[model samples]
Target: MTEGLSLWSLGLAVIVVGALWIYGVNRTMMTVPPEAQKLSPDSNRWSKELMRETYERVKKNPIDIKKHLPPKLDRRYIVVGGSGLVGGDIVAHLLARGQSPEGIRIVDFAPLRRPDILGVASNVDVIKTDITSPNSVKAAFSKPWPASVAGLPLTVYHTAAVIRPGERSLQTYDRVARVNVGGTANVLAGAKEAGADIFIATSSSSVAVKPMKFWKWPLPSLASNYVQVFNEDDFDQPLKAHDEFFGNYARAKAEAERLVCAANQEGFRTGVVRPGNGIFGDVENDVTFGPTLKAGDIVSWTPHVSQNWISSRNVSIAHLQFEAALNPSVRAVPPPCAGRPLLVTDPCPPITFRDFYSTVSTLSVTPVTETYPPPVLMLILAYAIEGWANLIINFPILTKLFGWKEPTGDLAMLQPAVFTVSAYTICDDSRARKSVEEGGIGYTGVTDTLTGFCEQMAVWNARVERGEAGPLKGKGAAAPVVA
Candidate 1:
């Protein structure tokens, strides 16, 4: 009789263990909203596994941005900030990749709103929006579409900012925050309302800037310069002041970036792309480094400061890639990955700051180091940038003072951005290149920075024809190349 009882007890324990396993399975699966589970078990497993793998790869694997973006389930994409060089490049890449402009949408703070390529605007729709106000974003997304337009949700590529090297101020910082952060927040809300599946924010490497409030800090220049920007480093070394700007531009960027992360946590599948030195079409004019130029059109530069620069075209492509990787209809794509924040340098590294000056001086026909203004001038420019950034952030319309005379065109980006690349931060992209070469995605390199610079000057000259700038009152005919 005792033997029988022992066997019965063992059987009961086994039954309990099986029940617990089933219960746990159901419980975990339930966490994935019921709407999501209705998908085929195989599909569900694939998605869940992809999501898991994506996070794991991000944390442990060598950073391969391509592998993280899953294959496309739905192809429609929306590009915010498409009016800019980087944003426009993203839209064009989407077209090159075969996404019909009918499936493409572009939005910007600039005045002009036009249909994307593929003549879709002629049939579908083109939108204009103010990112800071959710209302503007929602209106843009809700534009009427015909039956010809597929109902598939979207992959949103947000690549917009109001930064220029020479433009800065507290008010400007607030303006950037409202637009960068606020506009992002509005877009996130709009995406949710429209049921867009993936979100990719064109982030900046500027988030890595660190402050140098320390006494006798070794990396003071580096530290102070970064402090003027912002850092995403999750460490306890220094506590950040949450209230306001170190200078206007950095503060707004900091807040905007923070909001973007918050948006990620709130269930919108998001990716943040931090790129440095975008050298695409018109970026050189009145944006990028244009604001840094002195009244005499001199650039605010240090010949020796090494920085990272990437093509605006590459950044645009990265957005499409993130979009292509997403699963449409679902709220989020799992495991191959979710959206991520990456530092997009270049297929190859950039020249050092010293190299940059050497080349530009040679090409622009100016003595770079010698032409570099006094130390006091650099300091003034730095302070002026901070001040102007503050004004712009607080009063968007007030950017006129920075020579940002128009609400549209290259007037928004008031300065060139200087991205500091530490030795370790620059890594090899052979794997990514291999993937692109395999034909799943595509990319190209800006081999010669000087050529890139000349290309920029040429584009700037074109903008004068665009009526964005008046007839070129002849400035330097061509940048003189040092023999």
Candidate 2:
């Protein structure tokens, strides 16, 4: 009789634990704050016809970024990471505004791959240099410019950084810190050595993101703290603890930003531009929309999460605006914009992940598809993946013992850190928009999020119609867990 009672007790305990697990997952996943709902666009607004019309309209009358381009200065340029999304756009804008190609030098780890900049590649010098190595950076910057523009003052735009949003472990800090932190220091030293009068580093708004706490006891009716408003206010305060940031990437960037801002002096003006989350506007290599478009399908767990986005072009514009603000000839002595970080974002309100997925699905001729999984389930999987990754990283013998390979590509990106950044984040650009005289970057976004998405889709659709690319085949890769 006692043995039977014990068996019954074990069964009851199992049932209770299972029931509690289900309840916690469902409650956490389903609890969206009222403010988040207000921030998200209505589901009714994301119809196929609407997205199609927007695509067509944008194709007919595309955004004219040239109109918003800052007037070109005569200064010679050294754009580190110039082949990347933001740096590429900076190079294109400089050329579009009558800056001579000879006057621009691209110091990047990667060769020029951007189609837009490839046309001018021959005229501009491309110096492949790794910023992590102080010697490499110094040599790249020390290389003599063409005699024609050698006399012009130099402005350096440092835009390179390894982006691993899902990584939060201090164990993995060395990898990112080598590039984001050490590289920034190397680039800053090299620029000063090269006699650069102005330096602008590309920073991320993720620096201000606080980690999300979803498993609090007595689970609240709403996840109010998950919704955050981001600006430059954090710059005024002491840097938070590394764990306080969403991940290692943000922590490294925060340090890099401090280094760049503190380097500002009477003649060597320095600043940082913090682009809002979800930077898109590239046909390839964009972290947000491009991955879904490339895969031709998305497995989404964030349909209701809303976050601000910024376009690469607009980010580039902010950099140039900062340069103008700090230019000795353009502004008064001790420029108000120098020695600070400015946050920038699209001019529109935040949009839900569903909105982004729907726009791509509706407009892509490649037949994009989406599946919405439970957010809590994905969160659980992220933790598991992170554990396995850390295990393999910490113990190389385990791989040989169990034939285990480290996660790569999208799978490697799945981690608990992603959840913090993927939460509802709305960035405000008002501080950056204030006039330069008032201690701001005097920034403006040329294209809003929807328009930017529509414009990119139109380009892809045109390429498909012209038979330049695919109606691709096979199952698409898994969508990224974080934008």
lDDT of each: 0.47, 0.85
Model 2 C-alpha lDDT versus the unseen true structure: 0.85
Considering summed lDDT, which 10 consecutive residues are worst modelled in model 1?
A: 418-427
Tens digits of per-residue lDDT, candidate 2, 242-286, equal 889999999999999999999999889999999998788777667
The window of 10 residues in a row where model 2 has the poorest summed lDDT is: 474-483
Q: Residues 1-483, candidate 1, lDDT per residue (tens digit)?
A: 999999999999889975555444323312322222232122312133433344344335332324433343445767788766677666655554445667877777763332223342333234777788778899988775454455765677777776643334343355567777777788878877777767878766544543322112232222223212222342123325532222345555555555554465434666566665434334333233333221213333343333455656566655555455433444233422343344455664434434434333333322223243332333334345545545556565666655543322222232323222221122223322333224222333433343454444444334445654332222343231110
Candidate 1 accuracy as TM-score: 0.60
Q: lDDT of model 2 at residue 104?
A: 92
**227 in model 2: Cα distance from truth in Å?**
0.9
lDDT measured at residue 166 in model 2 versus the true structure, 0 to 100? 84
Query: Candidate 1, 224: how far from true, in Å?
Result: 6.2
